[model samples]
Target chain A: MDSLLTLLPMLVKMAIVVGVLLLLPLPLTWMERKIAAHIQQRPGPMRVGWHGLLQPLADALKLLTKEDHIPADADRRLFAMAPVVALVPPFLVFTAIPFGTPVQLFGQEVTLMISDMNVGLLFILAVSGIGVFGTILAGWSSNSKYAVLGSLRSIAQMISYEIPMGFSVIGVVMLAQSMNLSQIVAAQEGLWNIVLQPIGFFVFFVAGLAEAQRIPFDLPEAEGDLGAGYHTEYSGIRFSLFMLAEYLVVVMLAALNVLLFFGGWNGAPPFVPEPVWFLLKVGFFVWVFMWFRFTFPRYRYDQLMTIGWKVLLPLSLLNILVSGLWML
Target chain B: MEQAFFLLLAAVAVTAALLVVLARNPIHSALALVACLVQIAALYVLLGAPFLAVIQIFVYVGAVMVLFLFVIMMLDVRKEAQVRFLRGPLLPGLVVLAVLAGEMIALLLHSTRLHAVMGPGQPVLEQPSVADLSLLLFQEYLLPFEVASVILLVALIGAVVLAREDGASAAKAARKEPRGAAR
Candidate 1:
């Protein structure tokens, strides 16, 4: 009973974090529309609420009300299971991240983030890696040629990029000498990881983009060629879940980048709270992601493979070597 | 509670392992194998080797199993037949299986008699950290580690050589693809 009482507040905090994470998509969707529009010299979403701020609400309603569809010959179990699989890993990864230092709540200290896992970054990687199964299974079970091809591309893409992602982060882990996210952040007290490991930062950013299947790396759903790709058969909220999963992963990876490269909750001292600083940095990273999405052209499939395997993989290995020397 | 969790994980692992052999669809079998691997990882966690559990997930589920599933899906192996489990090697297979099972049962039954001592709720072995594991690997197990890598390298090369088609065969294979045929 005492343990239950102790866990009650922690559970509440977890609920709040989840609620906040769920709602984050709304503002992010708004921000994405606004940025993409400005990038293309167009006035974006300005009709829903002030400057179309409530646009995501309308979009969500539209999706929620839409008819869900499963094909006649599709694998029913797997087809229904794919989107949920896509949705889960990001939530787990998000909860593992430590957003800021602990805050005083009801005379007790509560950490801004959900959990400070000892192997937080590793836990993030493993769970997020499983998320690739979503796209793979989505394509395979859809019983569509295009979807299968897309899944092939997706599988190949992830396998190619995931290595670089792991190697890239190895530099940060080596410098911090810990797999704990909070410890990594704390280690950056004097200087951020980006300064110490510029190549690592660049590699991580690019790999992070690919990891979440952002534009330029979004070959799996190359609509022009593959007709919406793996999600060609999905409709309604299930489709929305895939998109939500992508965006959530993007946000999480961006947040991770900030924590690993930029100093987490580190900014010029002001009256603002720590979480606020963390959020602003994360928001900036998300904006940069959107900006890159708008600006960059998608790479050819072969080029993507070559870049991941030949360019980034070797570069990350070199970064590790250099970082090891620096650490020594 | 921990025992309950362990039992649940073990049950799932055992069932999934069975399904890996019993399932008709190759994809289903691959997925079942993945499920079994994941459940084993969870069981590892419940056993207090959280580091090993994470590595098990990372290396096995993340890389190996995904590639397994990818290959199975790519080959489009729709419906595999009820592969004869025993067929001609029934006696030998059963002997091996019985031996394996007996070994496992003996190990589990006599677990406490092995080296490591556990207290009331302690891990069977000390829950070593990543640093400790790495230190042991580089220090005492350094030669074995290097030998393992060399063996892995040879196996990788062998796999590539086996998988790669000769020029004529490559051309023939390429000619079978829709896009390649068009070109």
Candidate 2:
């Protein structure tokens, strides 16, 4: 009975995190559109509700009310499962992320995380990678040439960039000597790991952008060529799910960059509190992501591959070497 | 409770493994492989090696399997085509599978004996935490790790060369005059 009572608050926090992540994508969609509109010197989403504060809510309602369509030629089972597959991984990755330090609740010290597995970083990477399967499945199951091509491109782009992304983190892992996010943040007490591993940080930033399929590296979803890319055939709520997953990926990437490179939840003054500092740091990266989207043109597919392989890969390897030497 | 959980994981692993082998569609096979890998990771967690489990999921399930699914999908292999089974050498294939199955079953049954040989009632060693694993990987496994890097470099170079060869061949084909023009 005591144990059950102790577990209740932890479960409640877990529910909140899941709910917040699900709801986060809605506002992110509005923000992205508004940012793009503002950059182009146009008014955006003003009529919906208080500069379109309720725009996402309206959009969600519309998508919910829309008809769910499944093409006759499509692989029925996989097509149905793809969106769920895509959405689950990002949500699951949120489990290991420590939003705040452990607090005493009902005489039990419970951390504000769904789970703090020993290999939290790797678990996040693994689960996030699984999200690619959904994209691939959606593309293939659509039975359209454009969808298949787009999905192939996405998979290749992700795989190519992931090598550098993983390699880039090798330096940080070396410096901190840990895969645990909390420990990594704690190690950055006096000075952040980013100070010592600037090359790794840069490589990770670039690779992460590519992994998230943001502009500049978004060749898979290149509107000029592949139409809507992997989700070309998807419509209604299915399309919304894919869109939500994309924005969520953007948020996840920013959050991960904050946790990995920046001192997560740690600030100089210590007055701002850890969670607030974490959110601010994450917000900074999110803004940078938006800025990049506005500023840069998309790279040619070959160019993207070349930069990932020839540039980021070798640079990450060198960063790892330098980190090792520095440690010695 | 632990036994039930372990049994559930085992069931998932076995079912997924069978699906990977038996699925008519390559895409389905890949998904099954992902399921099998995830279940294996769960088993690794039960065995008190959470780090190994995560790495297993990360490297094999995440990176490698995604590549496999990508290749399979890109090739657009038709699921309707009947797989040519045991075309010439049925006996050898069966023998090989039998041997493999026998070894797997033997290992499963004798694992307890093997554990006893290591020591009776000896505590199962706690795996090094993520921090310790990183330290040991750098300190002790440095040589092998560097060797792995070299191997990856070689593979990267090979892939580049192969890609260039294909590009050159395509360019040559494009440069050739039309056969009708020659006529």
lDDT of 1 at A318: 99
Pairs that collide in candidate 1 are: none
lDDT tens digits by residue: candidate 1, B1-183: 888898888899999999988777777787889899999999878776778888898889888988998888867475443454446757887799899999999987788765255436553655456777789999999999999999999999988876775666887777788776578
The local lDDT score (0 to 100) that residue B163 gets in candidate 1 is 72
Model 2 bad stretches (over 4 Å): A105-107, A268-271, B79-81, B84-120, B131-183
lDDT of 1 by residue, A168-241 (tens): 99999998888989999999989998899999999999998998889989999998899999989999999999
Worst 10 residues of 1 chain A by lDDT: A110-119
Candidate 1 residue runs with Cα over 4 Å from true position = B79-103, B106-127, B165-169, B172-183
The iRMS of the candidates, in order, is 1.0, 1.0
- Once model 1 is optimally superposed onto the true structure by TM-score, how far is the C-alpha of residue B137 displaced, in angstroms? 1.5
- Candidate 2 yields a Cα-based lDDT of 0.85
Question: What's the lDDT for all of these models?
Answer: 0.87, 0.85
lDDT of 2 by residue, A1-328 (tens): 9998868887898889888888888777788888988998998899888998899999999988898988889999999999988888888888888876777767778786788776788888878877888899899999888898899998888888888998898887777777888878877787877888899999999998998899988887888999988898898999899988888888888988888888887664557766777888887888889888988999998899999999999999999888888889
Query: Candidate 1, residue A31: CA error in Å?
Result: 1.7
